[model samples]
Structures are given as C-alpha cells and as structure tokens.
Target chain A: MRALRLYLVQRVTAAIMAPLVFLHLGLILYAVQGGLSAGEILSRTQGSFFWAFIYGLFVLCASFHVSIGLTNILQEWTSLKRIAAANIAHTFGMGVMILGFRAVYAVVF
Target chain B: MTTTHKVSIWRGGAEGDYAHYDVPARESQTVLDVVTYVQRHLDPTLTYRFACRVGMCGSCAMTVNGVPRWTCRTHVSKVTGGGELKIGPLANMPVIKDLACDMTEFFEKWQKAQSRFIPTKTRKNPMEPIKPDTPARVAANAGIECINCGVCYAACDTVRWNADYLGPAALNRAWTLANDERDGGWADRLKAVSDHGGCHSCRSHQSCEAHCPNQLNPAASIAGLKRLSTSAYLKGELK
Candidate 1:
C-alpha cells in the first residue's frame, strides 16, 4: 500500500487500540489489586466469547499499527526500496499477529 | 571600535572545508558584507551569491554558524558573539561550488507539489471576486509571503530523511493555493500532495518554522494540508 492508505489505516488502528489498551491496563490493575491468581483469571476468561473477541481484535490492530509504523521507519531510515520495505513489514506483522493470537487463545481457552 | 572579525567560509564543492579570514568589522556589518570583503580583498577566488543586500531577495542564504539564514539580513555583531563566523552552503542540498548549493531539485519538488494558481476564468470572462475575511482566504494570506529562500527546505528534517519528500516551502505554497477560492483546479493538486513524498512525511519537528527568515510557519501550513488531504480522503474525493 502507498503511504496514503498506510497512514490512514495506522491512524484508525491507533484509535481502535486506545480503548483496548485502557481495558487491558484496567484488567491488570484490578486483577493484581484483588490478588487474583493466573488460574482465577483464566477461570473468568475461559469459554467467554466476549473476552476472546476483544483480545482477538486487539492483536489484529496491534499488528497492523506496528507494521505500518515499521514500514514508514524503514523507508525513512534505511536504503531499502519501498516495495521491499513493505514486504518485510507485512511479513513481520503477520508473524507477530500469529504469536499474539496464540497467547490470547492460551489465556482464554 | 575597529576590531577584526574572524569569518570561516566553505570553499569548493561537497568536500569543501572552511577558509578563515580576518575581516575588519564595522558598525551594522551584515554577513553579506564580510563575504563581499573576502571576495574583493582577502581572496578574489571566493564565490557567493547575493542580490538586494537589503534581505528582500533571498539568494544570499547560507549556513551561518550551522543555521540556515539570509546572510544579507544577518548582522555580524548579532551572530559572531565569539568574534568568529562559520559559513557554509545551505544544508540538504548538493553543493555546486563554494557557498552556492544546487537548487534544481528544490524547485523541481516545488513544482511537483503543484503549487500553481490555476484559474477557471480567462481574460474573456469576468474576474471572480473573493471576500478577504473568509477563513480560507485568511489562511491563504497567512502563508502567501514566502520568498523561496530554501532555508525551510534546508531545515526540514523530513526532506533530509525522505529524499522524495517535498520540503516545507512547496507544501506551504500548496496550502496557500489550496485555500484560494477562485482557483478551480484542486483535485489534481490535492492528489499531488498526497503522494508518498508529500505532506504526510512531515514529523512536525518545527525546524522549518524556527529557521525561516520570513518568520513563516510551514509546520502549520503542512498541518493544513494534512487536514485537507484527510478530509478529501474521507469524502472519497482523493485517490
């Protein structure tokens, strides 16, 4: 994608991630403050479709935002051609998203 | 009151170094005066460009002590607090000779940004009158006094990092024309600015605003372009 599409999508993904970030932080604080163990947290998340969807969407947005940002940085800071940079960034994003979704699944299921 | 001013000027092309000269400082001596003196008396081989030594013409812009500025308007007393001056060609441009950097790429990018004022009316048609107080016109008027000095171009980190990025002056010019109500052709111009090397590359460093001799805020102009481009994209008008 050209910078036009990439720039717009990066911004959109950032907006989507804002609330997700707050929710994740709030969950962490609540869990720690309440002295909840990993098993206890997993008990609440297990078989919960709502938690799965929210975390799944977070992983997707995070991957897309990271990929777009890295593409811009590679273009500006390196001698890599635009196509090569985009290809590398997309590959990296896909790898990261796969790992992130695996973690989300482990915690939820 | 006749102390000597030590000036270091760049010599030759890209591989040049500073050549020092001890010029006699006078009251209200501009940096342009020191350069002219070196070329005239100290070393005739010295070369620099200047016009309208009163600062109207911006051809005399050079890196004075690591900052890009109009040498014609810069006073020796103000810059040389250490009694020494270091002058070189403007940054972010290939040096042609001594102090004059090649400006071809700069002008080419300026044109590429499509800053032209394309009118919808010809001489046969009546001129369309625009109100001065309109917000768009006021925004246009804010950035209309650019002198094409290339200082903003030199100071822009975006242009330095992204080779194809159209520097501040061109985008500023585009913003001014984008606001002009009488200029009918905006679709093409808007597309031109949305390219990979267009206004999106700016990191809002504000270096262009800091170094512009005319006190123009190219950062704000670029922000304006960003807003317009985003709006156009939302409306499905820009591709």
Candidate 2:
C-alpha cells in the first residue's frame, strides 16, 4: 500500500513536472539570450503572481518526485527499511517544500 | 581438432566456489557442453540440469559469467573471458545443488499471480474466434512467449529484495491473462497483483527485460498491469 501510494505520487508529480520542466527551460533560455541580468530578472519576478504560482507548483512537483525516487534508492541500496525510508522521504519532501517556498517567496513576495 | 578451454565449474551448493577444469572445446560449443565435459571426464560429481539440447525445454538456464542465459544455446565464445568460464546457479534462488536452483518458490509465485488460463466456455458452447490484431491480443502477444525459463526471475532485483514481490515472469503471465478477452478471472488476478508486493513493487530497473532469453519485455507488461490496476481502481472494479 505504501509502495502504491509512492508510485501514484511519483506519477502525479511527473505529469505536473512534464510541462513545468519545458516551460522552466524555455524561460531560462529566453532570459539568458535576452541578456537579462540577475537583478533585472528578480525585479520582474518580484510581486508577480504568475511567476510565484508557476515556480511554486514546479517546486512542489519536483520535491515530491525527487523524494519518492530517493526513497526507493535508499530502500534498495541502504539498510533503511520501509518505515524508516518512508519517514526520511517525508522529511526530505517537507524540507524541499519549505526551502523551495522560502526561495520563491524571497523572489516573488 | 581437439581444442580445449579452461572452464571453472561451481562444485557445491550455495556455499561453494569455482573449481577449475580444462575441457576439450568443440565447434559450436555451448556452456552446457563445457559442464558436461567436466562431469564426464574431469569430475564425475559435477551437477547441472538439462533435458533438451535445444532451447525449447527451458530447463538448462544458469548464470554464465554473472549473466543468466540458456546453457544449451549459449555458445562458449559469447560468455567466456580469456578462455576462462565461471558457471553458477541462478541468482535470487536457493541453490539445490550445482547449477540447479530450488524453483519451488519461483513456480509458486506463478501460481500466486494466477498465471493459469481459466476457460469461460465448455464443449457445448460455440467457439469464440479471437482476432490476432486486436489491441488486447496484440498486447498479450508481446508477453506470451515466456517459456518459464526463470531467466527473468533470476535477473529481477525486486524479487531479490522482497521475497513476496511477484517476479517478472509471474507478473508477465498475469498481464497476458489480464489482456485475454475470454478470461473471466481478470478482476481476481488484478486484485492478486495490485497489492504491496505485486506490480506496484516493481522498481522499473528493467533487468528482466535485459535478461529474458526469449527477448520478451516483461517490464512493458508490468507497466500495462499498473495502468490497468489504476484504471480499475478508478472505476471501483478492483476487488
């Protein structure tokens, strides 16, 4: 049941990440090619709902995906059993979300 | 031409190491040929299993140099390194003796996965013709060629980790039954396969796909099962 939940979560996050990944890559290329400075980019991103929502969703999906994937690796490679691996994965997911939201807030709000 | 190859045969049970023997190699020599040479001439006690010299019987599978292959068809040139060969029992299984694994658990998982084909009609009922190109039949065709060689079972790391996890062949068999139009036990089979140690337990490492002797893709079949189970769950069809 835990494995199923993780698989579902990973699939859901992957679906979200698919488009977000392309959009993120496109934005990076567009920004770099347009010769936008770090400060200018930050200013444009600041107080923007669009940028905040997009980046926030991306971060959530990414965190969930990475956490699930890492949990599998830890369970397979290390001595961590199911419950311990799951707890560690949840903790890591929380860390990603908190840190990610903070960085998004720093830029957006 | 009396040609020879230096072969190392595993001599004991799970606790055994490789013992070296120089055997006369023949044209189109197979790994089974090397083992037979060692047992017949060099040592009389070397143990292995093979019925058909051809690949049809699915009985002569072993690990040749860390790769699971059918010993009858696997030529010496394909696996031997520096004229040295190491043959061992299939991994992820209890070695009953030299090169023969305890396939009880292996076949038992097949039963657990409900791999048997259940008929929906009797002799009085008219025959239902199945189209070869139908979507479900096509999907079944992609995975139905398994000869029960245990090659994929040996190659699967998920089975190694979780003993209850249904390995590739069993899951592949389940997928075929799930896609069969005439099979009445689809729901029951899916329920049996969707639990913690079933299709959901697969890590998608694809080692089974890599090592299948018939070159069948069990990974794709398992993915199909995952999709089927998820869809069944959404429709409240999964028991």
Which sections of candidate 1 miss by over 4 Å?
A: none
What residue pairs are clashing in model 1? Answer: none
Best by DockQ: 1
Quantify how close model 1 is to the true structure by its C-alpha RMSD in Å. Answer: 1.8
| Two-chain complex of model 2, DockQ on C-alpha atoms against the true structure | 0.39
Each prediction's DockQ?
A: 0.57, 0.39
- Top candidate by TM-score: 1
Measured on C-alpha atoms, candidate 1 has an lDDT of 0.90
Put down candidate 2 lDDT per residue, B117-154, tens digits, no spaces.
Answer: 99898889999999999999999999988989999999
DockQ of 1: 0.57
Instruction: List per-model TM-scores for chain B.
Output: 0.97, 0.96
iRMSD, model 1, in Å = 2.1
Writing each residue's lDDT as its tens digit, candidate 1 over B116-195 gives 88988889998777899999999999998898999999988888889989999999999999999888768888898987
lDDT of each: 0.90, 0.87
